[model samples]
Target: MKHEIRFIINGESRSLTVLSQQTLLEVLREDLGLTSPKHGCSTGECGACSVLLNGEVVNSCMVLAAEVDGADILTVEGLATDDELHPLQKSFIDHHGVQCGYCASGMLISAKALLNRTSRPHEEEIREALVGNLCRCGAYADIIKSIQVASRARR
Candidate 1:
């Protein structure tokens, strides 16, 4: 059955018709044309499909589109405002946290969620929060440093 859902995406309100079984990531990429959230391990094991659901980090690949009805969703593309990058995004560039760039979007969203809740997360907390995100380039140090830099800048 197709269901009509109203949700806020990237700070914009949208109404979409979606299948009950469709994942948010699929809907975002296929239906809405928001492709920043990559389709990695569709099983939610990979944080590559991470997004912010109501300001909390979630694996979009694991979330049903119907479940997000009337909810607020934020994709990596929403991080920038008026062509200005989010602090995390800027920090990632400044710290060279991106290599292959496949995991960058998810990592940025995860970091954004963490900073949203805690403006200044400790290094250990940052590491723990990002445990789900796997960067093939092994840029863990730079990623952590980027978050720290963003956190400091936000203070």
Candidate 2:
């Protein structure tokens, strides 16, 4: 069945038709052309499909597009404004947290969620927040450091 979903996408109001069984990842990539959320593990084990749903980090693959009606959605594309990267994005680049770029979007989103709740999170807290995410390239140290750097930059 098709359902009408109304939500704020990347800071803009949007309305779209989504199948009841369609994952938000599918809707975002197939319907909306937002390609950052990778289709790594469709089972939600991999954080490659992470996105900010109503300001919370969630695996897009685990959520139905019809479930987010009237909610706010923010993908990696929304992190920057007018060609300027978000502090976390800049920190990721500077700290070499991104490698191969497959997991970058999800990692960035997870880090953003962490930074939003605790602007100055400690190493442990950062690790805990990002526990759900996995980087196959072994960039965990740099990812953690990037979060720390962004946290300090926000101070």
Candidate 3:
């Protein structure tokens, strides 16, 4: 069965037909061609498929595409605007937060969400925000630093 749904994606309004069981990750990668949200673990354990669903970080793989009607979604692809990288993106690059790059998108989205709530989050808060994301390359230090720098810059 297919259902037509409308939602805002990356600041743009979008409408599409989705299957009841199709995960939002599938709709974004397969149908919409948005690939920043990586496919790591199909389970919600890995935050590799993270996205901002209505401004809250969530695992896209765990969300039903048909359930997003009238929702606003933001992927890592939406982080940049007009050829300029977001502060987190720049901080990540400068701080070497990304190594294998598999978990970068999710980490960035989580950091963005955290920074959205608290611009100058403490180290503990940054760590807590990224607890859901796992970096295989052991880049947690750099990732935490990146978020910290970006958070400070947001002030």
Measured by TM-score, the strongest candidate is 3
lDDT of each: 0.92, 0.92, 0.94
Model 3: per-residue Cα lDDT at residue 2: 95
Stretches of candidate 1 off by over 4 Å are none
How many pairs in model 3 have backbone atoms within 3 A of each other, for residues 3 or more apart or on separate chains, i.e. clashes? 0
Deviation in Å, model 3, residue 8 alpha carbon: 0.3
Model 2 spans with C-alpha error above 4 angstroms: none
Q: How many residue-pair clashes does candidate 2 contain?
A: 0
TM-score of 2: 0.97
* Candidate 1 per-residue C-alpha lDDT over 1-155 given as tens digits, one digit per residue, 9 for 90 to 100: 89999999999999989998999999999999999999888877769999999999999999999999999999988989997998899999999989889999999999998988888899999998898898888988999999999999986
Report the C-alpha displacement of residue 153, candidate 2, in angstroms: 0.8
lDDT string, candidate 3, 1-155, tens digits = 89999999999999999999999999999999999999989988889999999999999999999999999999999999988999999999999999999999999999989988987999999999998898989999999998988888876
Candidate 1 has an lDDT of 0.92
lDDT for 140 in candidate 1 is: 88
Q: Which model, 2 or 3, shows the larger lDDT?
A: 3
User: How accurate locally is residue 145 in candidate 2, as Cα lDDT from 0 to 100?
Assistant: 94
